[model samples]
Target: MKWSKSSRTLRRIFTKSSIGQNPTSKGKWGTSLTSHRNKLGTSRVISTELSPSSRRFTRRMPFHHNKSKKEPNGILHRSQAYVAFIDETFKGTKRVPRFMDDNNIVKGREAQRWIVDTALEMADAVRHTLGPKGMDMMLVDRMGNKVLTNDGATILKSLETKDPVASIIAEVAKSQEQNAFDGTTTCIVIMGELLRRADELISRGVHPNAIIKGYRMGLSQAIAWSEEISEEKEAYEAGVEAAKTAITGKSAEDFVDILSDICSRAAMVSSPSEMMLLTVHGKPEDAELIEGLVVLKGPATAGMPTKAAGNIALIESEMAPPQAQVSLTDPDQIKEIVAIQQAFLDEIVARLVKAEVKVVFCQKNIDSKMLQLLRKNDILAFRNVRRNDILKMVHALGGQLIADFADFSKSDMSAATVEVVESAVNDYVVVRGDGIKAASIVMPAPTEQSGEEFQRALEDAVGVSYLAVQNKKMVKGAGTIQAQMSYRLLSGEGCATADNSKVEAARRAFAEALLIIPQTLAESAGMDLMDVTVKLGNSPGLGVNVHDMVLEEMNVFEPLAVVQSAMSGAVENGVSLLRTHSIIMAKPIQEIFAEAERR
Candidate 1:
């Protein structure tokens, strides 16, 4: 519920936000307090204060009244204030109209200005990381670890902050990343602009409700425009170009053609959320897409064959030495115990060999003795495998996982193929079958750190490119779709069969906000913003050629679903922030006095 202009300022403080999100604190709390005294010499500061159980604010606004009897300037005599005309049973106390409490209050302009400005500053931080010519952000952690990349998700997640507003902005970035994985920077930019435009409207004597209404209308039209334009025509290699656009921001620029081909092939056999990301230590050009699962670990022994194609045995439990249960009082007893355990382990291997299983995947570590036995028998045993990877391998091969040696029989085996190839990078195992539904996009980097950056970029590109293929179309990129939506929204030529001039102020604000993407791209690339915007006329296929600085059709494209998702998330973030008239900070009793210990 919204509080009135004169309502008391928000009460209490807490470690959590209203959206139920917990931000990474970076070992610090982000809080700002403002206060002032009224002309009557009483404080009306906006800060935290202790309250008794009865005075604590609840979910509903608290009623503060009936503490005084006399009206101001003696306007009401005793008879008028008493109201003796009503019957005794019908009498009820009234809350007299009052200004903000002498203790707490937050004005509209003050709250709106700061929140909008803070959001804009965050947007600016990521603005330069958009489009082909965008630059990367070199993020250094507290331990002096360096990460150099232009991926929006990487940049936002790498830096942690304690401020509530920054936390909320992080949520916006996360939503964009999880939903589409493309257009994260675009979504954040639009959200900040929405708030910026909203602040201007509030300053221009417009009600917040009106601004909200107009924004909703504009958002609806933006989504509709995105859907209507659908996909760009497949004139020539459109799919390749769209995939390239998704990974163009310097992270994969050196070999986007090969990366695009690999991403497209991986998408054919993998689910969007289940796609695997594998990083190997080598050159960037060694990237490959396997139509199967990568265990991320190699065989247990170097003597084992690098390639194995036969019945597979998937072990879910550890393949280690026996766990001694009885205390040995003499050396003879200990020797007997060790001999018995060794025989039992040998029998398990013998069973696999009899079942014609040539390869084994152990979920847990394998003892060195067992590895030597498997190597001598020409069996490829992959040890220390992750549980998730084990599950994927079993599912891909259409086999059942056996947790115990007794439970593993001929029925548990499945026909499969596995390869342990050695490249300039580390050795990794690839498991495949006749009908596998998983795939891995492997990228080789000069160092482990750069490999991480490449993996991040591939993840973003894969999701968006897959979405475009699923939606059956794409829109011309390089600011083409946004420019069309802006013209349609502001010129009043679309969005209805009737006039929408009543909310023109809000609609105009939204339209101008759409241009920020193209304008920012131009300025970052050292080109004239006005010239770029003019070249990006109110046409569907018209977009700026970033390299040539000319206005023409480049056949560039991105998924429509990405744009729609970004718009939905950005608007939701902006509207929620706008509806917040005051922030109620809540803190626990212990934390209230946590600092006193240090004193």
Candidate 2:
């Protein structure tokens, strides 16, 4: 080969003829021969032809760098080669890699799909527990304890997975539980449906933002339609209906008639913040509503009157002797302290007696001497009552809570008829008289598990009933509002135009998603889902009655607030999840610590 002054051969040139023949054999290389100028203004060419044994050594020399040429496909090509070379040159030293590496992060479509799938899994876990005919789930903990529940919030909260989408769904369910208290399953089911539809539209080339906007539009129409279709009823009537809806599927279903009246009466008498629940061990049939408050504790002493009718006093201060800061070493000093404490007790009793206070609720302990004094005065007293109970008593009887005995007066007391009900297991103080403002539910459960479930059921009932009374609105349930909302959103004529096709697709998807509630209801009740949903789509005010599988105007009613809140919350959360384009999971603490130790 002749060396030209205009170019430099970085490696000895090899042609096909040169492989086995003489080194000077002239063989024109094929199209693989190329030339490029280096940064130093020198022309360079790298051409090689070799046998299998020497092919590993054929690498592009540093002087022949070409930006326009594409790298050949192989493990040892281009960037891979650079990485391998760096690793070989610094084999013993540590080099920090990219953040989260590639394995720990999911981006773009994959991340969105993973989130949608995870959310759907969580939603499905609770979907089977939707509506009145929904089934219950048995949750067993690591210690072998079990809970059977159909409450969506309970089921979602019981899920022990670490998936982020599941966590978000759980949080949304928790919010639903706190706000409306009876629509967690509805909220989660709607969220899953929205995400499913949104994913579909995204696959069909619709933008996520367009889907989100359509969801907002659907939510606005739903809220408007809900308010328009709601019925106005008296507090007690609404409470009765709401309570029935809340209790239909629980273990307390056998007591529906009895509990509905009790819950309604409870809500009618007192506000949600003022009403109290007292659970006792007995049959569910034994549950009753008390016209006034009942404390689980009895009078402080046996000699005190079991029943009295006079003024009720709520004392926040302790009726015991003050703690002596100075320790006494002599009997004389101790006796003096005792006499002073007795005088203090006598003064407290005299004050109560003079004020005509018949009942006393103390937030702190009462000294033994004070109990005897109160007994002599024909007054009933309870000591060490919880602060919450004291507040309830105050709110119930319209009395002031006095923290200082010196501040106690006739003005601080309220009139009440007090009675001590003695039982084999416990004693209760029932206070009922004129001007009493609070109501109490005395619930009897046969077992601890049943008691907890009963409480959960009542909590939902009371919360929704109270909200109904506050909002003064009730919507038809059993997927009535959902079907109507879906139809109205899809009825827009402009949604079919080409200029707004993306938005139109999104609107149509959201409309379809809204029917998932009705579909799930039909499925749960063993009805023909397709037939029921199609009929529901045509009928405006009619809803499926799960008992008969008939599409008609059923008497199921839910609070308007619950319906609107569930729809809005579900859509907002679904839009939020759709906007998430990437997810990067952090390394476990153990792995981080190990890596640090190695460093």
Candidate 3:
């Protein structure tokens, strides 16, 4: 009765059969018939026919079925057709998969090798510019910007490089800057020396691990020695010694005097706790002679005389009375507050009149009423003096508050005493003249805005001095000696109080020196450290170029299997070079890596 459905279901099951299964079974027939009946509907019935060849066949043909002679394509057979169509559509296209292209692959092992080599190269470039007698590098930027300085960090930072290895060298240079704040050249030279030593080991077929081990040992010793060298009992003494060391065999007395004077000035103005002075309207040259420190208590806008010769009367407070705080949130509040504070201000003016204080410095804004009162009392008052100027003015005022009001008189004016005198320019006061006047040269006070620039200049001068000393030692030339003398100045001794700075500087110098080794090797490897630096400096997109160059030049073998392997090679080579050579070679190498990584 349902033989047609059964026979159709059997055909479906046999078509789906794989390698193993029973060809005929009653249970299979039952299951097949049920599945076919459920899909085709219960009303559909199977019909059977015996062909001319006596083969029995079942057919369940609905009204929609044609029951044609052609056989249906099997599920597996249709799948094959679909796959063929898809394959044809995408044939001969540029969609082939690959792993080692510029966009995807990073030849890390090659980069590591290049980095190590470039580090050594850079270290060697500045090797001679080390120690107290180190030479300077004249850096010229791409825009033809010229910088004549011996600071190792400055020189390395300024150079253009593209090698990944060179960037690593630059890091070492930066490390020097951070560690020493000075003697960057020494650090780079030391790095170069170490790198050279590492190269020697590599050439000799020594295991990189062994070389790295030896280098680490040497670095440990060098670091200890560096710490010892930087250790100082007294800041002033250390400053003097550093100066002498910086200028040895060339105007010894002048160098000592100059250093001492700077130390003294730093101590006086910056406080004995810190050996650095910030001037808003003065230069280092102005503080050449020890005239005690002063704090001018006035407005920041008030201009002081560039040079004033005579006994100076240093006023600790403004010539004008203390200003009363007034809320000017409302426009009308200004007039009312000014009127209300006028009476109290007049009484303070009376004291200044009696004291005959000529120049007064105010820490607050000057109201019209106070200005009028001061004018009537014939007192000159300046407002908003900077902190540095306040210190200088207090020292010049003979330690007296001009106003003598309770609020203004609270500051310690003992340190504000000054020598007052009449000068050709104007009536002036010197903070602590000691009766000595050497052509008063007025200059703008040092302020936060200009302090960094001035400090850079000072650092450059020091670097130049270092270079001159180095030149003398290297070539024994009279020109170098003369140059040293030209820059030399007399200063006092045991005046500085910056112990931490000296120690830090020493530490940095040693660290920097240690970094120069690998840089030299990078240079030897023909890596263009400058190009790498320039690309990194200009744009991050150029990092690809840097990475490519590193891989092309530094990889020892083809088809690096993993990135870690390359990284290990680089680190090992870099560390080994640093240990064996001076940092002079290391500076460039460190710089190269720094540029590439944007570090």
Candidate 4:
């Protein structure tokens, strides 16, 4: 074959002939002759022909390249020019891979490890701040929103990263949130510290197994310590102390006595059968007194006495049964039940209209029908009386039962001469006639606008105070005798008196306070596990290794930007950093170390 190239195209020319003996063959292929033809000036082609059968047997091979393509599947390698350039400029080094890929990256579990380590390192950096004096974290979100908080869960949750391991740490924070409403911050700090310690252990070449064993032993002791600390007697004392601390911060003189009095009242009133009473309206000068402990549902009206003086009627229930117990399960049942209840309620209204009963309290539903009837009869019937209100009402009135259409003659009316004194400042009425002066309080209100604000404030104060005390004790590693007692008393599982409702409330408060310590410890330990293990044990040659060391190295391998990004992602996903810290921190250091040793 001969070929020639032109400006537009290339051309080829061929010359060949075959000769045969047969007449047809002789005419077309008998002669073996060669002919040269001009193709595009100088191009020539040599041709070889095959028979039809030969052609049918021939096959073409697929094309293959000797060298792999620089780019595969349209994806650029981490070492690619653009990637390397960007990484160098932003990361200040090209040693680390820019993207996740098999050749130049850690992915899957390995990637997760890197993330976990990085997060633990950050946690350790703040571990010292585990107590009430703990430090705060300043976080800036992707949108430039800034948050400053000492909450561990908040910090962990705020972290965003593509690393799966780091995400696991974030999960620890979530666990803490569920276990302990507070202490997320302490947990996170503890986790970070543990990891840091683990890294030191690793450097010392201590076997991971030994560290793991130690950690397990320590955890066992810690759990036992928690149990010991939370004894009932101790818990009560702690509760008293906590209350004193809170009150004293607000007032310095004999705050302990005042708190003790309040606690006594709580113990007395907190009963499932009765309402707890707390008085919160006192004269400005008497505000420091903090007396008249009654649990009422709503706030003191515009102007009311914070302290209750005089005798109190402690009614345990609503003065009347529900007009109806309407069942939503069946439509017909609802109407029939309501009608029946209304009929019974009408009789009670009739009696009240006769002026036999001055104030009436009821639990459960008071149908619209009953309301209209009572309004028409000029009988004030308050429905859904809270536990606190019941106690107060019972205290004020001598606990009498007025049934349907029961007419009290002049003698009966005069016999029960507790006059109702309406307070202009509070939502309760004081019963003061017949030389009987008593206050009525309520518990949870039926309506949203009724009494939630005061309840929430009290709950918050109690919850925070409890957490503070627990954190303090855990930091000291002291036996938690107080915590145990508080838990039993407050959880309503102990052998406490059943009648006094106030005592029950106090018990619950104590339990809440005792619960804070262990929860915080568990969360903080978990967080530190990954890092602490690494510090304590040398890298495992082949078997299981400490999570702490693993986490530390992983963090060292990851860039700060990745860490920050992962945290941001976590927060955007609605994961709370505070919660994450609590969970990670809650893991006992001993447990992690023990696991390491076993490995």
Q: What's the TM-score of each model vs. the native? A: 0.77, 0.74, 0.38, 0.35
Q: In candidate 2, what are the lDDT values of residues 1-599, reduced to their tens digit?
A: 32121121223343332223332233222212343343432233334443333232222323222334323421111321111111111212121211234355667886787777767767888888888789999999999999989989998899898667789899999998888877998898889889978888889888999988877776776677667768998988888889998999888888988998898888878776787788888889989998888888987878788899989889888888777689779999999988998888888888888899988888998888788788877888999888998888787778898988876799989998989888666688888877777788888898888888898888888888888777769988888888887887678633332247787677677778888888898898889987987797778568878888778898889889998888888989989999999887787899999999999
Cα shift from native, residue 278, model 4 (Å)? 9.1
lDDT of 1 by residue, 404-447 (tens): 88767888888878898776547788877787788888888887
Question: Taking the tens digit of each residue's C-alpha lDDT, what string does model 4 give over 1-599?
Answer: 22343332222222121111111111111221122222211111123233332221111111111123323433222221111011111211112212322233433432322333554555554443343323455678889877654445556777776544457666766665544333344345444434434334445554434433433333333344344433232433443444332232121223335433343233232321222333444322221211122322331122223222232222223334454433388888777776766667776566555555443445434556556665554444445556555554445444543333344432333223222234334444333345324322333233332233323223322433344334323211211222333333433332333343332332232233233333332234354433323322332111111223122221101111111222223222221221222122124689989999999
lDDT of each: 0.71, 0.76, 0.37, 0.35
TM-score comparison, 1 vs 4, better candidate:
1
Badly placed stretches (over 4 Å) of model 2 are: 1-107, 140-145, 158-165, 324-329, 470-472, 493-499, 538-542, 549-553, 582-599
Q: Per-residue lDDT tens digits of candidate 3, residues 412-525? A: 233223443343333334444442221121222245434443444333233323222222111111112111111121011111212343322322232332323222222434
The full ranking of all candidates by lDDT, starting with the best, is 2, 1, 3, 4
- Which candidate wins on TM-score? 1
Give the worst 10-residue stretch by lDDT in candidate 1. Answer: 81-90
**What C-alpha RMSD separates each model from the true structure?**
13.9, 16.2, 25.8, 25.1
lDDT of 3 at 100: 23
Question: Would you list the rank order by TM-score, best first?
Answer: 1, 2, 3, 4
Query: Which candidate do you rate higher for lDDT, 2 or 3?
Result: 2
